[model samples]
Target: MDLATIWVTFTSWAGAYSWQVIVTLAIVGLYFLIDRLTIPVLSRSADNARLTESSGDRAVGLARLLTGTLCALAMMVVWGVQFGSVLVFAGTALTLLGVALFASWSILSNITAYFVILLHPTFRRGTFIRVLDADNYAEGYIADLGLFNLKLITENREAIVYPNNLLLGRPCVINPRDRLRGVGKLPPLPPLDVVPNNE
Candidate 1:
């Protein structure tokens, strides 16, 4: 190659390459647009499915990660890497992809744990949770339900972080559900019309 061609190809930053920048931006933009458009549509479709429902978060997370990787690789090519280096780039990309997936899984797992706790009939902010398999117990108000762990404030006011998987397996004492049945005889109330006369 000519001296000028070689210099431009090997030494120019990715931003200096007009075509690369344009193409990469276009792909990234399209990826975001498509993601935004498909999410609600797919969620609706899944809602209609009788047998099962898919987690929109998981699908969206996967798409965003893969698309971002593609954008990064496009930038790398613009940096003038040789064709023979593509395999190396591919391997690097795969490593990055694995890491991203691992992190996403961790976050998703934590979020799922909190959701399970909120759904239990007897679980409330101040309820106690006891794991059947594990010999641990968390008592106090449920401070926060995180994706990977439960944030519980014990009676002594200590914060506890319990893994999502463990929280899922634990049995919760649901106050509302347990209290739904008649506990015993109730005190008699005066006539409802007379009691509300002030209002």
Candidate 2:
């Protein structure tokens, strides 16, 4: 057809899908906006934990994955994908969620605790920490903060791998004024005092 015929047909098609185009653009803009606002914060957190500034990419990646999923779902609705198509996978998703809840609960908890540790102002890498336990004590410097577990290096250079959640559950004493924090020559930790349990 001539240019005039093409222009008329295109206008008609655009008029029919105008709402979808507007909603899709809005959804995409919102997705990028959320990522732009959140990624810098998460990236700073990751950067602090890792000295090289590379781990921050993981934060960016995770934010992209989650926001992409949310925006994709919104776009699907705007385009009027049938509910039957969505419901088809709901059963499999529910089954997998159930298994994760029961089987990988501890793993999930540790991952969550990693975020808590990053946010906790009092505890951090290089903080001289002593965990008071009933059986024994764990005394070391907060050598490395990680996603699932923390790596502690004692004054004697012994490594203690502790799960994230259990580390948060215990009472910890942090001595920021410790002169030998990085030298691996920490002074003797004070004896633990037993608090009487009322229960």
Over the stretch 7-40, how does candidate 2's per-residue lDDT look in tens digits?
9999998899999999999999999899889888
The model with the greatest lDDT is 2
Give the range of the ten consecutive residues with the poorest summed lDDT in model 2.
Answer: 177-186
lDDT of 1 by residue, 143-173 (tens): 5544466566655667767676666655644
What clash pairs does model 1 have? 110-147, 110-148, 111-147, 122-174, 125-142
TM-score of 2: 0.67
Model 1's C-alpha root-mean-square deviation from the true structure amounts to 14.8
State each model's CA lDDT, in order. Answer: 0.54, 0.70
